[model samples]
Target: MYSLTNNQLYSMPKAVRIFASSALSLGLTASLIFYPSASQAGKNDTGVPAELQGEWRYGRISSIQYQDSYTGQSAAPNGSSDQFQLASNGNYKRNRLLQINTYNCASNLFIEEKGKVKIEAQRLTFQPSDSTSKGQICNSGRTYSSRNTAKPETYQWSIETNEYGQQVLVLETADGKGKAHYGRPQ
Candidate 1:
């Protein structure tokens, strides 16, 4: 009833050592081939990557050159929150809320879009079947549901893992003007 210690195993013959190392390597390679990580779980029914088939909330934005303001109040206090819901069936819904605060007034805008999304190469094209937008400018109030006649919006996209190990979806404008970062709603 003898047990081989690590020292005894290391002092074994060269042939035995090589064989043991090869066996260990083969086991690791086989495990990797059989068990994939969550991200590598394969595509959804709509062909969306497994990592991108979920709800993501707006996190931040950065322009290619400078910080561009959507409300013209670049230095003023502003807040925005958006959500992108991607279904495995190729359907998606986006809800966005933007508020702008100026020295004299504040404006708010909200937009909701529902559509089918397609991913090709590194681009994601959203063809909205329906859309609704409502906003208020200072004091004036307006509510409207208009058909989106604009062409399908497409963006270069990728999922990046931050230092904190959180998945962030980076969507760059088709024109390469800016990138919007989104993450899971905490």
Candidate 2:
């Protein structure tokens, strides 16, 4: 516990001081990074709409696109350019990026999945057209393959304008385990 006053802490042994300071520093950093600020807590928005099709980008990386979340909300800001090529031919290819924010560093991990997609009424079904690999890509410690494309992952999706006025495609995974939001980078 940091019960010692600043004066007392300064008088403590060097080893004790270093350990305590390191622990405190790490805890504070973690809290600050994860604590949602007022503007980030949540904003008023029209929920996912019933129609979402065509192409969308995460930000500006023409090669990078779509992101996934358990809430189906926009994971990135309104300026991301994640690309999604949704075609009427029931074929699609999109990049999924997972941001690892830690170690005083930020890294983007992505995997591209391609397959056949069908949007009927309110249901969106996907049948992977490529079974070779999901294409594992990591911009970090090591390259790892993503198991996201082992089989078809379907979702019920809709389009909506967020509070920031960006058109977003929101979806919930088939297993009810994750929700994701997609939008055109402004």
Candidate 3:
């Protein structure tokens, strides 16, 4: 019968360890060469999909100047600039004015409008507000006692792989009215 000491049994030859490690590494490499990792295995299963869940600075509206031909006068001659910000926490603010010019002699004016919006997935709903409007020349103005002016708006958004292997976000309004392209921040 053959007997081995504890140290002898526990200790392994350096060459044997090296050969074993090399074989194991080679096996792993071969497996990787043949079969992809779980992450690279399937389409639409690229893990949790990217969402439009972040703070976004959607540019700015500037140079909103208007002039009327009949009066040969400028109402908002200096014009104004404003910003729009959207957040993932279902919160949005448009600290700006939507300029709608009659492009006529009467030259009505609308100013100081602000509102909040909520966003979910691809859908967006805006809290309604009073439609307060004013007439410049005629000195006639009225405030509509209404909460929501229009319907709750919804849209579709998507994340796509770009040419650089990076993900991008594409947004389209529900009514097919507007579309926007965006990319992840650096």
Candidate 4:
């Protein structure tokens, strides 16, 4: 058994120290060169998750209209334009459904029309509550009404990336169906 003295135990040869330092420095350089950090991976050019579960600010409302060929009547096609303000804090709200802090609306009228909304991967679905038809009149001179008549409609939404890497959500739905164009507030 060869026992080293106290001084020798704590001391390393000059050559060994130099070799270790060089190896460490080389490893660090290699890591930085080959494996860039997440922040350095092109300016964090990412987009909102497929699931729109966070808060979104209200943007615009574009009414979609169409002609009912059968009745030759101009009908207010089922469609709506809305915005969303998403927060990293995991809180989310839809402009067409509820008025959030970032939304500017006199009343929650849109909510009454669209009802509750939920976003799934690349799709948004909502249903208008029966209460929305409170004073709505039908063509028969009777009050328009519904008992859970509002059914859930789904829309396929996508995120578009431009040259600047900014993102925009493109929403499309069937004609005479739910609203169109849902995106972040301008």
Candidate 5:
């Protein structure tokens, strides 16, 4: 077996480097690393694994706390929820909603997308057939809507056990800047 130094490993392409680092850290072989059946679930004919087929939802709330002149300390809250339906044959639909409330004003956005998906080397790629987006601000009475066809989007995907001891699907953007955790509806 050959060994790679940090310098050599860091010189690889981003995806390769990520794969290599994960494989090395987990002591997994290349073949075992990307095979869903080895760790999570079995794959179907289209390479969309069984674990990924079904309804999954993600929700998160974020708050910013700051000192206020009159209130001493206050928090501004925002949150988002996303739902995905993945079919056995590599078809998918997604609905996402986001809301922000602060200073007696509220803003909301809703997005829907449908597409075909494929899994390769732990990466999930979505080829969107259609998409729609709408947004509104309550206080300003401003609203907007748009419909567009999106290009293919890809993300690294994995299955993990969440704090509740349930299997969750995790997807991260290629740059690792955006991540979402999806779980089966309770």
Candidate 6:
């Protein structure tokens, strides 16, 4: 019932038209990315494994905590907490809080990401839901990969019990450049 005439669209300001077009494209893309297609919606729901369903947390952890990464080395030294929550419906979320402790002050920086994930043959694959910028700052737009920027990060995961007898979520990057250990939250 609703339609836009070519003349009317052409009459709008160029910037307005571009913005509207971009907005519509982004909305369509988001919907397609986040929703399952008709043929795959409900026939079989292959969710993540049971032991990996709850919340897994890291940081505030000692250098000697869980097995570092797949290589068994400790992760980089940083003041941050990483939490991962894998739901029953294959939906997953990860929240990272970085604390910058200066000589006399402290600031908190946080980033959140969500997507659908599933386990197959003992391996967990994350389909990241990040679709935008990594920072909210006005000028620099410094990446969120550090203490001051908003960075979008990703990882592959697994369930493991550390030497300390605690359940841990082992996460590593696809290239093996990054690794982390998140213990079962107490």
- Per lDDT, the best of the predicted structures is 5
Error of 3 at 14 (Å): 90
Ranking by TM-score: 5, 1, 6, 2, 3, 4
lDDT of 4 by residue, 1-186 (tens): 001122322343443233222322211000111121122222112333433434333243224345565666654433223444443332333333311111111111232233455444455454434323221122323332223333455566554543444444444553423223233444
Which residue window of length 10 is worst by lDDT in model 2? 28-37
The TM-score measured for candidate 4 stands at: 0.33
Q: Residue-wise lDDT of candidate 5 within 48-88, one digit each (tens)?
A: 88888999987766544334566665535666677889999
Locate the minimum summed-lDDT window of 10 residues in model 4: 26-35
For all predictions, the C-alpha RMSD in Å is 23.8, 18.0, 29.8, 28.7, 11.9, 16.7
- True-structure lDDT of candidate 5: 0.65
TM-score of each: 0.64, 0.47, 0.35, 0.33, 0.68, 0.50
Between prediction 2 and prediction 6, the one with superior TM-score is: 6
Cα displacement (Å) at residue 133, model 1? 0.5
Over 4 Å off in model 3, which ranges? Answer: 1-51, 57-71, 75-96, 103-139, 148-151, 159-170, 180-186
Best by TM-score: 5
Clashing pairs in 3: none
Model 3: per-residue Cα lDDT at residue 183: 50
Candidate 6 lDDT over 106-154, as tens digits, reads 2334556677775655456656565221222212332333222223334
lDDT of 3 by residue, 1-186 (tens): 011122322343443233222222211000111121123122222122225444332222224455676778765432222233444333444332222233432222232223445544344444424223222332233222222232333456555554666555444555554454455556
Local error of candidate 3 at residue 156 (angstroms): 1.1
Candidate 6, position 73, lDDT? 53
The clash numbers for all candidates, in the given order, read 0, 17, 0, 15, 0, 3
Taken over the whole model, the C-alpha lDDT of each candidate is 0.58, 0.43, 0.34, 0.34, 0.65, 0.47
Better of 1 and 4 by lDDT: 1
